[model samples]
Target chain A: MDFFIQLFTDPVAFWNSHTLLIAQIGINSIIASSMFIVLYSGQLSLAAPGFMAIGAYTSVLMDLHWHTPLALNLAAGVVLAGVVGVLVGLPVLRLRGVFLAIATIGFIEALRLGVILNLPITGEGLGLKNPTADPLGGINMVLVSLAVVLFIMWRLTKGRLGAAWAAIRQDELAALSQGIDVARYKMIAFVLSAILAGFAGGLEAHLNFFVDPGDQQYGVTRAVQILTFAVLGGSGHFLGPVVGALVVTTLPWVFQQAHDYINIVTGVFLIAVIVFRPQGIVGRGGLAIVRPAWWPRRARVSAPSPG
Target chain B: MDQQLLNAIFIGSIYALFAVGYTLVFGVLDILNLAHSAVFMFGAAITYSMVVNHGLPFWVACIVGIAACAVMGLVIEHVCLRPLRRRRAPPIAALISTVGLALIIVAAIEQGQTGSLFAWLWVDGPNSVAFPAGTIPNPTWHVGDLTLEASKVAIIPISIALMLVLGYVIRYTQVGRGLRAVAENPRAARLMGLDVDRMISLTLVISSALGGLAGILFGVALSDISPYIGRDNVEVRGLAVIVLGGMGSIPGAVIGGYLLGLIEVLALVVLGSNARGGVAFAALFLMLVLRPQGLFGAQLRERI
Candidate 1:
């Protein structure tokens, strides 16, 4: 209640006090958008965190070693992630559905546990420290990046490329018959998602003082969380995942009253929301509530016969 | 090497048990029950609580824990999968819902302090605990360099017998026929007078029961039980097992489980402990890339 009250009643003070939370929301929204691209293209690829790891490590490493500006560092990270994305995407894009999802899970876990945790440059299990992190100051940049990413998504989804993606999503065989290159479009979406995830990772690295390589950071857990954002938000629309990111990231603050039982509330909320709104919160239908089949219908009072 | 091999087989039994339930649902309904792991942990947690907290005998506690997990499976089917099935929502939606249920179950156990709401369920409050010493009879045996505990040795026979029983039931029983009919084609099964929904519900029950039993064995054998046992121990590894053997293949899951145990042991021996987890996932990745159908799986069918 206080969370909502403050947001509605005193916007300026709320921003000043909850800058970190707001910044996190921005970063999550960006990652969620990255998830959105793959889901929109009918792919259940969960390789976002893997790409994010590459982006994060590359950027942070550059900053630590050469003292490069943040822009150059971010750019290098994004490019490296894209290159890795293409390399990984080629063989992986051959798989579909849950197979793709599992394969990607394997990718992220291998990257985190196999590569990142083993490399001395990545600080092994200890994680790297970013001495020049600017937590509060990075908020504006994050918000701006989110806006730009969303804009690009909106435009892309409305264009010819988006049509090809929608076609492929609906039916790969049918889309192929219609002359759409299923593999190419899937690769495109996967690579684009990687680039965006990489960008989000770079921004997130700037926000925190330590680049932790824990399971919650760049592991399957993070991948699932990002998936939740796209899923809960509605992967059908560009804005749905962003809304999901906002709702999910703010859930802890919103359910502060639940305290230790917050996860229960979150779990119940997730089940209820998905059960009721399987298409997600921001789907094709306007804000209508979906009642399950088991719910009893209201008694219809018949009008008196006019005869 | 002989001792390690013994350890591998012991741990492999648990992995095989856990993956059996995971692959069962996938085989029948083609939906990954992410909450299966939660049921696994819940089984161990409840059994631990029964023995230590409520003074129940270990065997009685085990039965009750397994029954409770069976009930949890029903809840999952009704609350998470059924509604979505009715709505004809995409399979991905089921993933999210099951994840939600998993969260609730884990949290319920994690928050179970002395006076907390879930105190009846768990009282550890997110801490890892083991069954108290002497709660279950555990006698140790030493054969040359190999040291074995009764608890660990028991896992091999129990898991193999149960799996063989499951295999027989799946292959020969009337209920198994119904389940296979449903799995092969739901519409056709319904047309053939098989209750598809019931079969699905039954699948959950059997799967969750096996998962629970596996968890009990794991906790008893490894001497660790917590809200995180499922997550930390077998959640992802379960996936690798099913995939390695082939998704939706019972025999494959069994083989894959032992194979994974062997591989992890081998990785530990050769590449060190740090590479153990990485090696497993790398195997999973390579398996999917080179052979998406797995060893026992039929030709891959795309499902989302």
Candidate 2:
């Protein structure tokens, strides 16, 4: 209760005191926005976490080995993740919907358990310490990168590419009939989404002093968390996931009293959202609900459609 | 070689038990019931509670656990699935809804332990108890240069019996026919005077019961109960099984279950336990890429 009250009452104080939380929220929003791209194109690819893992590990390892500036390491991380995304996407994209989801999960688990756990370069899963971690320096970078990603997403969605994506998402056969390359457009979205997730991952690793390769860090759990942001925020619009990231990242602070039951609460809320507002918290028409028949009519301004 | 084969068949039967239920839900409903595993965990939890906390007989506890799972299945269908189905929501909506249901159930079971440590300690902790093997006799079978724990060998025939029973019911019973009809075309089934809702509900009950039975078998065979056991092992392997067997194919699920079991165990022996899980999924990844239709699945006409 006080958490919410404090935020509402002392906005500046809250922002100053919760800089880390704010930065984390910004990073999650970037990941969520990236998820929004894949979902926008009707793909159920849950490979964000895997890409995040790739980005985090690549950047952190480069930093540890060469003492490269953070920008170079982060860039390499994003590029490598995108490359892997393409490589993985080519074969697995043949399966649709839930099958695709499961296959991607397989990809992530194999990567985490088979490669990461076994590889000595990843510190053999004991995790690596980040000596030059800037706990405070990252906030500006996160906020600025988030702005750039959002701008790019907004412009992309408004362009011909976004139209192609929308058509593919709506109906692939129809999209193909219209001469839109369904496979190519999907690959583009998948790759773009990977790039965004990778960027988020690199930024996240930069925020902390340690890079942990635990399953929780880059496994099915993280995948679900990414999915939750899109689902709760409403995947129909770009803004939906951004808002979702904000609310979900802040929920524990908001419902401080029920922190222990946060998972159940989030689960219930997600289920309820799907049931009641299948479009999500933000819909095409800006929020939707089925009002009971007993609710007052719109002042009976019009009863003339039949006539 | 014989010992490895025996080990494979033993674990294969148990994997078949869990995979069959998972496949059944997917076959009929055409959506993954991610909470199927949570129901599996609940069965073990209930059995553990009854045996250790209440001191009930093992058989009695198993029966009660199965019954409770059946009820829990109905609740999931009602709470998580029915609303979305009625609204004619997208398939992914149903998928995500099931995930949400899984999350809630797992949280409730784990006592809100999100992203916790490795599962060994959690399962054998003070809260849950090991299955009492005394309730089912422990014996051994021996041959030249080979010995098999009766508990393990029993899984093959026991699972075979259960599969036979399931096959018979699906082939011969009225309710089974209704389920198949609905699976083929829900609207058509409804037009044909079939109660589609009732059939779906009944299917959930049966699927959940199978999951519960599988959990109990795991408890008896492994002699331990842990909430993590269901989602961790079942989620990945059950998925690989369904895909390998051919989606919506019962025989495919069973065969794929055993095949995957063989592959996992053999992979463990060859690659070491740490890399064994990756081997199964690597197999799945390859199978999906090369043969998306699976061994027995109908040829897929579309690609994502």
Candidate 3:
């Protein structure tokens, strides 16, 4: 309650004090958007964190060794992520649904445990320190990047590309029958998602003092959290996932009174929301509670027939 | 080398037991019960609490723990999976809801410190503690160049015998026939006078029971029990095991578990301990890409 009260009462102060939280929201929204892309394209690819890792490591390594500007570092990270995306996407895109999800999980765990944790340059388990981090000052960049990413996502969804994606999502065989190159469009969505995730990773790296290689950072847990954002937000619209990111990231703050039992509240909240709004918070229908089949209903009175 | 081989066989039994439940649910309902791992931890937690907090004997505690897990299975079906199924939501929605349930279960156990709301359930909070040394009878046996403890050796026979019993029940029982019919086609099974929902509920019961038993064995054998044993040890690795054997094939999951245990031990022996976790996932990736059907899975179908 205080969180919202302050936000409404003193807007400038809220922005000043809660800059890091806002920045994190921005980063999560971007990652959620990346998840939104793959989900929109009928692919359940969970390789976002893997690409994010690639982006984070590449950019942070460049900054540490070459002392390059942030823009060049981010660009290099994005490009390398894209290239790896193409390579990984080629073989993985053949698989569908849960298989794709599992394969991607395999990819991420293999990357984190196999590559990142082993390489000395990555600082291995200890993680690399980012001396150039600007936790407070990086807000503008994060917000701007989020806005740009959201805009691109909106435009892409409205164009021919989005239509192809929608077609593929509805029915792959039917879409193929209509002459839509199903494979190419899926690959495009996947690669685009990877690039966005990578970019978000680069920006996120700038917000922190250390580039930690923890499981919560770049592992299946992070992947699942990103998936939750897209899922809970409603994958139907571009803004749904952003809303999800906002709600989920701020859940801790909102339920602060719960203290030690916050997770219990959170769990109940997630179950209730998903059970009532399976289509997502921003889906087609207006605000309405989806009553289960067995719920009691009011009986209707019989009306007299007109003579 | 011989000791590692023996270790592989021992651990493989646990993997097979855990995966059997995972694959059973996936095979029947076609939903990955993410809460399954939580139940695995819960079973161990309950048994530990029963013995330590309540002062019950070890065998009685184990039985009570397994029974509690079976009840947890019903909770999962009624609370998480049922409503989503009623709504006809996508599989991913079920994933999220199950994750929600998992969070609740883990938190409940983690917050079970002294004087806390859940102190009655678990008093150790988030810390890892083992069963008291004398809680269960453990005798040591030594073979030429090999050492074995009865506690560890006990896991092998128990897991195998239980798995074989599960296989028999699934293969040659009236309840098994109902389960298979439902797995084959729920609507058809319903039309044929079999209660589909009941079968699903039964599936959860059996699956959760097995999962609980496996957890009890794991906690005893490894001498490590905590709120996170399931999440950290077998949650993801269970997926790898099922995927390796073939998703939904019982025999496959059994083989796949042993195969995974062997592979991990081999990786540990050859590439050192750091590579152990990595090699397993790398194997999972290659398996899905190169042979998505897995060893025992039929030709790929577009279920998901």
lDDT comparing candidate 2 with the true structure = 0.82
- Across B1-304, the per-residue lDDT of candidate 2 in tens digits comes to 7788777887788788888888888888888888888888878877776776667887898899999899988987887788878777777777667778887767776762324431321333324457655766788778987887776777788889999898888878887788888888889999999989888898889889988888888877777677677867687788888889877777888999899989988888888888888888888888888887788766432110
CA lDDT, candidate 3, residue A191: 96
Cα lDDT for residue A158, model 3? Answer: 98
Q: lDDT tens digits, residues A67-179, model 3?
A: 99999999999999999999999999999988899999999999999999898899989999999999999999999988898899889999999999999999999999999
Better of 1 and 3 by lDDT: 1
TM-score of chain B of each: 0.97, 0.90, 0.97
Tens-place lDDT per residue, model 2, A1-307, is 8877778999989888899999999999999998999998989988998898889889998998999999999999999999999999899877898788888888888888888888888876687788888978899999999999889888988899899988888898999999998889899999999999998998999998998877667887778778878877788777888888898788778767665567677778778777776666776656657432333657656667874
- What candidate 1 gets wrong by more than 4 Å, as runs, is A301-307, B298-304
Docking class of 3: high
All candidates: TM-score of chain A: 0.97, 0.92, 0.98
Model 3 lDDT tens row, B121-238: 8999999989999999999989998999999899888888888888898888999888888888989999999988899999999999999999999999998899999988888899
Clashing pairs in 1: none
Tens-place lDDT per residue, model 1, B4-118, is: 8888898889999999999999999999999999999999999999998888999999999999999999999999999999989899999999999999999999999999898
Order of candidate numbers by DockQ, starting with the best: 1, 3, 2
